[model samples]
Target: MEERPGRFLGVDPGAVRVGLALSDDDARVALPFDTVKREKNDKAAARQVRSVLEAAEVPCAALAGVVVGLPLRLDGSEGEAARRVRRFAEALELTLGVPLHFVDERLSTVAVERTLRTLNVPRAEQRRVVDQAAAALLLQAFLDARGQETWPEADSDEAVAEGPSPGDEPAPAGPRGRERRAGARPRRKRR
Candidate 1:
């Protein structure tokens, strides 16, 4: 654990489950955190997510912001799903008091599924971890994009005006090279 300057929470909001990921303090790596089982009430789901965030034990002040996966259609249009994600993001912002940033997550779940299959994860087991895996993928994209100078400041007008730039090319469909297992043990911190 080298001293990370900051961290960001990543969200993959779904109708039944909300996936969560946390970036390294340096914002270089994204790790699966947990999944929030949603109730019929959106507010209740938001509360569940907030509780998880609090229970992670990291200081809220160390978080840079929240990055939410926006599930846009292939044509880059916001469908009903995208609208729901936006609503969820708004509610989460209200609950957590953190700025929200959206990242295009067109095939995040598919990518996660592919990685699981490659790792020989059983179909039944995949269902349990898919959401969190997708969240890690989504957050990894945001973290990688940030390295490339794509992410704007959380409070900047350009962030509002331009939205999250996915850059000119789409992210790879699946995790590159090695597969990251769900709930993998955290790496030991170096002295």
Candidate 2:
């Protein structure tokens, strides 16, 4: 097979099972891969995930990174589930010795279920594959955001105070880190 740049693994950690998805060799599209039984502890789960990835035989060098779903609350606050996922992701990154990224996964599963229902997938089959689909959604979102070119760097207080020099257009959102981006920057008041 012709090798491309690299592949990225997407993970969705649930209470009982962990879903997995993999990006195409070009790292553009996400395909649902498999699901693994979760361990009670974060480190153990990480190890289990490592083994699963190794079984795929995609060398470490071939992995561009790992994208994990972070199930943040509707109000944008992290709950226990989010915290647990973070812990698991951290351990997995350390074990795999690869880059790890977390994407806001609020309602990701719900969206996947909706899509599956629209596709007329059986409820039983949906249960078997929803997690993997959610993983693909998370990875796809990350890939989409990373592909944007018009994103600007984070603006400091002075930058925001400058307020675009009277006529400058508001910059398109970046990779969601700055105070003005779509997800990372926390806003005090609801818009």
Candidate 3:
């Protein structure tokens, strides 16, 4: 292999929009790039990704691999959406001649939504920004789990520079919190 920066491309594939994210020039951090609309003809979406790769000056031979978001059910089961994503990834691998990987995207959308909400983004405007944000979340999650590079922990700089996103509600703190509060319900008086 040419062994360039080894930058990886992260994809959050959707029926209507395919979000694209890229690792840094040094392949150190993955950041959201763009969201390409998937019309009746998916060729349009592929073209958009090609443009992004070209604009970024991504070395065709240097791509370490492409990471795709795998949507899993609450019990970690793959559904139709997940299958579609996998199919898309496979097509990319064959077409682009690059290795492909998958990362669990169980709650990536939720995470992105929480981020937007924390930043005080407006609800009506969220549709325009959610895909890219989801892409960033998906890529960052993959990088973190792989332990492949030293991605910056600070999300502010990357996200802010890209642009503010409109998000959704934050997820509950954690399972422990949910459990702790599970029994704290209103007490009923004896009738």
Candidate 4:
């Protein structure tokens, strides 16, 4: 049998930046890793993210999955930013050939900014670290929920990066129609 990978990668994508995070060997905790410049093209950006994943303690070949921040609007509708992320995430999923999932990330950066300010982090420092911090926050949330086997309703995506568009068939759900990305622990079977 093939060994399931041991680490999860987190991604926080922005117009000008892409934050990367890596989980502990057990995929139980996440820590900020690096911030890559978002190139004008998404394939280039995926290449940069691939570089970061390869640099982690666990290489891309050992990746369990990727959890990407899906920037949904406050109203729970996806906007331009969400679409943009889906594009980069799709390209990245192809580049890495790993399982892909999306976590609703409305206000995640705002929350991180508030914490940084409370900690008295200077504006310049906050700008440098906020995205990575947000990635860690999102990844941690996912890991915690996965541990409990009850993912938060608001944090999960109805469809992952390969979501359905208007006039399209509903996107496929994770194993057995339960919500999550591929490679996640399957929900316990019903009696």
- The whole-model lDDT of each prediction reads 0.82, 0.86, 0.74, 0.86
Worst 10-residue lDDT window, candidate 4? 151-160
lDDT value, residue 101 of candidate 4? 83
Q: Which stretches of candidate 4 lie over 4 Å from their true place?
A: 1-3, 150-191
Candidates in descending TM-score order? 4, 2, 1, 3
Count of residue pairs whose backbone atoms collide, per candidate: 1, 0, 1, 0
On residues 1-191, what C-alpha lDDT tens digit does candidate 3 reach at each position? 44334788888888888888888756558887777787544455555676677777775567888888899998999988787777677667765677887888888888888888888899965776788778778787777776634445556554333433458444445433542233355446679
Residues 1-191 of candidate 4: C-alpha lDDT, one tens digit per residue = 34366788899998999888889988989999888889979899898888776665457878889999999998999989899999999999999888888998889999999999999999999999999999999999989878876444544775244455558654457765756654566578799
Candidate that would win on TM-score: 4
Measured by TM-score, how close is model 4 to the native structure?
0.74
Q: How much is the lDDT of residue 76 in candidate 4?
A: 95
TM-score of each: 0.73, 0.74, 0.68, 0.74
Clashing pairs in 4: none
TM-score between model 2 and native: 0.74
Local accuracy of candidate 2 as per-residue lDDT tens digits, 114-158: 999999999999999999999999999998887764345457443
